[model samples]
Target: MSSPRPLNRRHFLRTTSAAAATGYFVGSSSLTRGQESPNERPVFATIGLRNQGWSITSKSTKFADFAAFADVDANVLGENLEKLEKQTGKKADGYSDYRKVLERDDIDAVMIATPDHWHTKISVEAMLAGKDVYCEKPLTLTIDEGKLIERVVKQTGRVFQVGTMQRTESDQRFLKAIALIRDGRIGEIVKVTCGINGATGSPVIPAIDVPEGLDWDKWLGPAAKVPYRALPQMREGYGGGVPLYTNCHYAWRNWYEYSGGQMNDWGAHHVDIATWALGASDSGPNKITPVSYSLPVEYENGYPTVDDQYNSPTKFEIHANMPGDIPLVITSEGDNGILFEGTKGRFFVNRGKLTGKPVEDLESNPLPEGAVEAVYGGPVSENHTANFVAAMASREQPISDVWSHNRMLEICHLANIAIRLGRELNWDPTKREIVGDEQANAFLSRECRKGYEIDM
Candidate 1:
């Protein structure tokens, strides 16, 4: 086998600059003469071609062709295939198993938007197979998985971009707020509050026969095999069936078995901003202590039922100690937003707006010369998908590369672990292990079903 390629920073800069000078947009069809061959576009396969996968395909088609698509749910896979054919005017092969997609030699990269439990496994395997990966966040379901992915990226030498799109959107309130904080207009960040809406609960319907096209067994890959149930109602197009009486699919976030509920779901986005502004993307909190927690006893109208059925923390006040003197408290509340308190003033940001005291601070302060550039490597691109394509072509790290993303993911996972354990736990980042507590350490990794190991 050939030796892997090194992703050197200087080399990336040089190539990017040269490409920019030549007016050749990275990954553009017009740039076919730059590398590979004029007749060929980089071929990519997408796993979990359901909800987010379709969006990724729409974005990627501007740069590359969809060579294949994979999803355990045949209904979703077939629907996406038709869409891809219509949009790209290319007939793409379909697969019920992602492993089969990875085995092909023609594919250059793989975009993974699978469930939380499957992210690390498929991403690591794809990287080991010499394909670059575009993986969704939170990058890993567990702390150990994050560490393992970080190691795999280093070992494989393949470019890996985490789908933290907020990092690329200049108009996003959260990203703009961080830029203001890093500019020192907000002063030293003393506190942070992050809120998530709610959690998913059990379904009311009973289990039913599996759908026709779906490979039910494959859908449960790695996850323990359970009886077939209608996909969760929250899932797009979920209708007409005896619901499994348990939340599944998109609602899986509410369950501990499949995801980390709102904590990991929305926390991944908000906490990422907190880490980015505090300049703690490489390390994590020293301690995570839950000050308060509340779970819903019933579901809202049109919302799924609420019960201990879901393992994720629905409501909690988690105080985390960062490197600074002040501690950051991440809380879940009715309103979803992120508030940052600093020495000079306070700033609050959410999906819709960014606001703070002494508003002029934001207008006057510009990001530090190298800080913003270091994170994104250049002027902010309007499009997140375009940024990933550019990074792939220039061989540079994307704004949300695997290493930085895994660090943020570690924070979310640790917060969940602490909440589940219902106690304070010490963390040792250097060792990548939970210090001194065997019981807590057990939560770091999960056992897969028979024949479904992560290939550690």
Candidate 2:
């Protein structure tokens, strides 16, 4: 199997046409043509320097020079800045506010991995500042935020890549899956099941003093003002040393205020690939039925009655009546991956494995050469950030463009609405609204806090 060659940053920075841009990839620390020339490197700054934020920046350092790092937590910003200095042998600036990083004229782009609530605000501002964007997925907290972002991308013509890396990485497993479906190896895709795994509900966390070096209000930008909350428990994996039960840090995923829980977290990944494979990225579901779900807290009128505990659903099985009448099942049960069942055969694919009869048949009845590339729209970039830079060079949206991402995310967002309201939702994809249910329709857009609203 052939892989993409490491791209020269210079070519990507200088190229203007798609054909010239398509040949290059990203993620090479050493310049092949001119090792000492600083002009060959694109300058970058990262916002939200937590786990995923640092992850993207780490990958990007190979192709872009780090100008600064920003985070609501001073500690995170300082730590990442120090790490970047050590890794690149160059000191970069650190800022508590992302706006400082945006103000720099030398920076070429910004990578946003902030919590779900803050994504749209930062992304919109970044594009308006003439910076291309590579934002983390489950990109919007609500459907309307996605629309706002789409508008900005169109108005600015800035390259935008959502952090749905499955389209590029995962060893091209997802790309191959899409190619298989197109190859008719799966015949007519009957259903695509995305098992994004459920999150554990949190116990009541009492209000506590905000940690020193962390700007609590800035961290909660665009989100409602709330008391800082945490339990004494400490998480111990990636992004560890943080409290395991809090509406901050790693635990923020469990709250409706900051995130969409497991649905948006993992659904952003697997469901995205499923939707791509199903060829439903341009359109959305006609209805969303919450087959079953369990929320950790009680709710009143779709709002959590209590705010101290994790309020996002703990488990769910949502069925979306998608375009072409395809049934897209996003559920918490089963293995953590996508299962594509079709008229002729079936297969299952996750980060680590792609199995079942169809995948097994590939050895004897292989897909055509360049199949993955066709699904990817071009040669895949070395990584997602590389894809973003390549897109910047070509002035084209990358494989994970916002338009397709929002179409699939509409299903996930509607599923949460269905679960919260304890009823099915009839959707009109063209109108982009909930049919007839005014109350559910209200969930499509959230009101941003007064001081943190996006500027156009």
RMSD in Å for model 2 = 5.3
* Cα lDDT tens digits for candidate 1, 161-262: 788777766365565676677667667778888876665455343556776786767766788887755534433254223233444555566666677878
Report the backbone clash tally of model 1. Answer: 0
What is each predicted model's overall lDDT from 0 to 1? 0.71, 0.84
RMSD of 1: 5.0
All predictions: root-mean-square deviation over Cα? 5.0, 5.3
lDDT of 2 by residue, 1-456 (tens): 011111342343334224324444321222212233324566788999899998998898877778888898988888888889888999888888889987877777889989999999999999888787889999999999999999888887777889988888989999999999999998999998999998788777999999999999999999999999998989999979899899999889888888898889999999899888887888889989999999998998999999899999988999999888889999999999999999999999999999999999999999999888777665667788776766655556666788889998888889999999999999999999999999999999999999999976
TM-score on alpha carbons, each prediction: 0.86, 0.92
- lDDT for position 317 in model 1: 83
Q: In candidate 1, what residue range of length 10 has the lowest lDDT sum?
A: 299-308
